[model samples]
Target chain A: MKLFKKMRGGLSCDDVMEVLQSYLDGETDTETARKVASHLDECTDCDLESSVYQNIRVSLSTNKAPIDPVVLDSLRQFGERVSRGEID
Target chain B: MTERPTEVDSPAASADATEAFNRYVIPELEVMYRTARSLTRNQTDAEDLVQDTLLRAFRAIERFDGRYPRAWLLTIMRNANINRARKKRPDLLDDPDLTFERSVDFAETTGPEELVVDPTFDASVTDAFAELSTDFRQVVELVDLNGLAYQEAADILGVPVGTVMSRLHRARKRIRDHLAEHGLDSAAALPRGATR
Candidate 1:
């Protein structure tokens, strides 16, 4: 299956893997992201990896504590004081 | 480089700096705190870091361009953390704690044979994250969680862009391997639109 998939595209799984991080991070040029996305469509392993990567990113960003209100207020006040030349 | 304002001490100049801080920098304190927490992993230390970061930033507000405040602040915070770390344990600079990665027996947990038998394992993503090496976790938190651009993350972490990409790739791979171990590798788990 992997062999057949590779035959259809210029990017084999290895090729896609090499630039997959840049593609995922949206740092890749349009041409490269397109190629990797095209390859991932037919490559189950790469597809799985792509999704797992997205899920992990979502999981990391979704679950987090809100910044403490006290902390925010204090930082704001401190900034004000610095502006006023009250604190160095 | 953006040219720094000539005088930050004049009342008008100070007021402008204050206004910029309120409009541009204050809004990003939450993210700054989040990154600080990730770096310190201790509540008190995170708070101190945030305070120190704000202090340093306000002092240098005349030089700030008000573009990409989070990245700018993170760069400062990263430096402050390094300085703090150096002060506490100067020798740690010579010897990093790389043992955390080696201490984990990946073979037993993520071995291919074990993955096959696990059937349907379930583990929290957070738990898997905790098991990652500090270096990997730092990249994950900065780039993945905080949504910093790769260059921004690299700038904040003081590594090359290529290093950021490679570390992010390996970090995500580790998390995926952990998920696979727990039997979360179902096709349904893949996000919609993963394919063209």
Candidate 2:
């Protein structure tokens, strides 16, 4: 089934996997992204691969260390000082 | 010796520089701090690096054409970080605790109770992330954790954009493989059409 789908002029599973990360990252060009999307829609294996990668991204993204608001506030104040020419 | 007159020396020019700094630099402080944290891997050093970058950006604000300010500031931050690294003791440069390994430790200590995904899956991903080389971990931290674009991560790492993409893809592939090994790559783990 996958082979038959590959012969249908869309990106093969190999081609999709080659650029899969870029396609997921939204870094692929529009045409390539469209092709990859089309391939994923038709290929169960590639779609599962994409899902696993996406899940990994979500898991890792959720693991971000909490940013300290105090530090951000301090930086903001420092930037304000710079804008006011208070810091040399 | 008399200092030559410059654009920044005039009152009007100083005001323009200040406005430009406020417009371009001020809004990006959090992002600057996050990138600094990724580079320095220490809170105190990250804050100091950002402060240094802010100062340099202020000094150069008059010359900035108000385009791609984040990229502009990241370049300054990268330079500042390089200078800071140069001044550090050689032994201190090899401090493993100051690496992204610490970020993994932080993840272990913090709970992801709010995430709806499987805890085991999350743990597997974190384990895979912790095992990545420093180069891979740095790119992941900058692009994934800090939400930086490929070019932005490359600028901060002083590498080519292609290098960033290559490292990021390879690193994530490692994590995906780890997940597959743990049997977490099953279709049941992820719904159909699930994507970020």
Candidate 3:
């Protein structure tokens, strides 16, 4: 339960929307995130919108093109060589 | 600003630097490669970029304090990417103070049925990510995808934390709207409010 709501009134939908990313990203202060969470509990629109944003983020993160094995090996070898000053 | 060449003052110090590079920097190649791939969006270019970054990091290895090597490597990669981009097209450079006022605007062009029933959400998301401007994509990759904090991403990109916040917000909105346009059928497979 957000007991802080009694100390600070709940944020309006527009206000919650304004910082929704920060709220989701855990960038918001504790009081502000709790306020946003409280708003989402009562507002289906913001809840669904937040869900969609998260999905997009997951997609971007997981959809990376696989690195070429040869390129990977080459980079590793290069790092080793460079680390040892085997090559300038 | 003029650049000073990094010099290894002694053989013992050089060996220490090499040891540090193996211990601190080698372990972070995968992350560096991923970030490079995201920035360059090309396999060849990404490889070259990582190579260039590693070279620079190696030269400066003696000065590294073994702190947050991944972030330090990423900052180098970001600078290398920008310098490469600047050389190709000077206008692609970012102006940190420019207000991204339209960060919240979106075109909700997709229907709920498409999001809930379709299976091509990943493809659509990939396309949308490609469609993003380089600036927006940088924050998304560093903050959202790479799981770096706002302050860390800002430091890596040489931008203010506020800029990272605003740009990331805008970039995520565009992505959300793009997913919405495709009807987010993928969400049906996920529990409500599930995040990576």
Candidate 4:
């Protein structure tokens, strides 16, 4: 399905799909990221796929559980004691 | 067997070690705690794990070379967690993969009736997240929720970086599918003025 359709940088929609997640996560290498970006720019189908994934990321991120402040404070004090050589 | 020479740190050396611990390890406590929480899935265990990690890091501070402290601390935390698990469940010694299966029980209280209404994109995503398997949800929690990079998540989860990528992408794909089912796949669902 659209495997042979080449977009910018000669990346097919399938090729972009393979690494699109990595590209969105900023985990892809420079060259592959560039190619995937170009392909997304030219291919509406791939672009929509990217948008959907991005929107999902945004939604998931919004629901991040808040770290407990009391827990964080205790950890900080623990670190301080460790730094002061109070704890072995 | 030859006995090794006893070593003792001079005052200056001890001070330097303390300085290094403060400089490198102090700032990463929160991240360490958060990762520990993800790994232990319980508040008390997470606190214990982080304290254990801190003690180990303090002991090793003199030789740390002060580079990539977060990565270094995470590696220590991973080892510490393995030891904790081994001590708790001796059976885990036979299968190493079982050591990293800690699950994060996020949003377990949201009832099914709440999910039935309000098919907004956010609601769909929350539903999908709840439905994800422990492995998929763990990866998402490490990378997306906890904001750890792929390599960092892999280090904490005791998996390869590629494994993290695979789990994270599949998890998000599942969420995207859920959104599509709610008619959120169209361009209208994209953020306003989102060119990418």
Candidate 5:
């Protein structure tokens, strides 16, 4: 907190957060995203958040458990049964 | 019942749902189970809770209305687990440290850093996250991992978008620092722009 006092309101944890979220969602524009990227390269604290957000992106995207085929088949059948009014 | 040469979005949805359930939801079981394990802190209770989430998800899908099926599924699972916990023990809501001990004896060979390389880093990160006050962790999980837009995650969690944004920043910073203190920090190993 003390370290970032120099950046002024021009760059804040919130601005960095917006950039971080934008980066993860792949929604940031080319120019500002680039600025955020370059700034992060030099800013250790921002770099830490940048790192965590990306890892979070990967973990959520890739590390999920695989739902079983039987479970899926079972759910599909249940969907069918409900569509047919088999269950109240 | 036959594979149509052309895709019907409805039937296709069912198939895609099946596939998503298999490809996405199934893979998350252990992780979700691990989360449930952390939340419940008992193997039997975690298993029961997980099974309940699966069943509830299937039932909920019948009337579900969302385009992002995976996020919708996780939302259901998360809500289900929380409701079950509340029902099981209403009083423990405020007291978080009841279940798991704070300290972990990480493996010597890997140290904490090596383990950060694995996807289980979420578990470590999540444990760090778990250390936070629940209000912060709620917003972090909803917006960050679940990928809801600020307003959407807020709408689902019933909070203001501004609240979600700020709490998330605090929770995120605390998580990063906690990982650092525990030696699981990913800053040194991660892609450069990633940390900034």
Candidate 6:
């Protein structure tokens, strides 16, 4: 939809995670901040969605779990690519 | 020299930047991975995406001001993921068997049951959250999950703050409507803490 497009396009899954991050941090603007608030008002889905994304990223105060070894290796290789400046 | 920061254009600078990145920034690999995982919801894709991002950051480190190093790297990751995603084909209806396979026991690593907060909802909340379009999910991820400021998210997303808020508002509202339609919450109950 054009409206969604206006929000911007090509955003990754990480971009969808901001609901709880901005709210808990208290950095979200009053009005835009209310987006989360207002979303909660009528939509339980956003409420849950916001909270779940929070769980995955922050896990509250607990240390984020270690990534899988294979995943780490991939990142390491990607990092090597970066260090090597091989990506176009 | 090429306008883009390239290894060949200035090997010394790239080398110095990579050394500094490895020492000071690469240590955040785990953190980047977690963020990437949350975004991609696929362990393999998340790792590759983060790897691609780290590589991009290393190459572009010459332009990095060493401010908000993690966020800078995240922006690179976020952008790389988007670009790579565009290169793929979307074939939702092409294969019924593949769809059936995905729907059977196909679970996001982070399920609603494992989710930390209770948020006064039930089982269907998971389905609703899953149903949201990718755009809405992006706003929730950036501002709500990772806690990047609107300006920073804007920097990564290349949108105005107003656009961010409005999209977040509408996207979230749509999700709420979805939940309500699913009969997950009551309209008359004593309203626990407001959803905000």
How many pairs of residues in model 4 come into backbone collision? 0
Superposed by TM-score, candidate 6 places the C-alpha of residue B35 at a distance from the truth, in angstroms, of 4.8
Off by over 4 Å in 6: A1-25, A28-70, A73-88, B1-19, B34-42, B82-107, B112-124, B175-196
Q: Which stretches of candidate 4 lie over 4 Å from their true place?
A: B1-13, B100-104, B109-119, B192-196
- Give me the displacement of residue A16 in model 6, in angstroms: 24
Would you list the clashing residue pairs of candidate 3?
B110-B181, B115-B183, B115-B184, B115-B185
List TM-score per model, in order: 0.75, 0.86, 0.70, 0.86, 0.47, 0.53
> Who is ahead in TM-score, 2 or 3?
2
| Best candidate, DockQ | 2
Please give, for residues B1-196, the per-residue lDDT of candidate 4 as tens digits. Answer: 1122224432223678778888999889878887887788888998999999998998899889878899999999999999999999999998756876755557653344443322376676887888898889889988887789999999887889989998998888888777777777774355532345
Instruction: Write down the lDDT that model 3 would get.
Output: 0.70
lDDT of 3 by residue, A1-88 (tens): 5443322237766787788888778888989887888877777666777777766666655654455678788899988878766545
Which model, 2 or 5, shows the larger TM-score? 2
Q: What are the Cα lDDT values of the candidates?
A: 0.68, 0.79, 0.70, 0.78, 0.54, 0.54
lDDT for each residue of candidate 2 in A1-88, tens digit (9 for 90 to 100): 3545463127878888899988888899999988888888778788778888888777778888778799899989978777777675
Classified by CAPRI criteria, candidate 6 counts as incorrect
Clashes of each: 1, 0, 4, 0, 18, 23
DockQ of 4: 0.45
Q: For candidate 2, lDDT tens digit of each residue in B87-182? A: 774454655234323343435534666345677888888889888888898898888888899999999888899999999999998988887888
Which parts of model 2 are misplaced by more than 4 Å?
A1-9, B1-13, B90-116, B187-193
Chain A fold similarity by TM-score, each prediction = 0.70, 0.89, 0.69, 0.88, 0.58, 0.40
- Per-residue lDDT, model 5, residue B113, is 32
RMSD of 6: 11.3
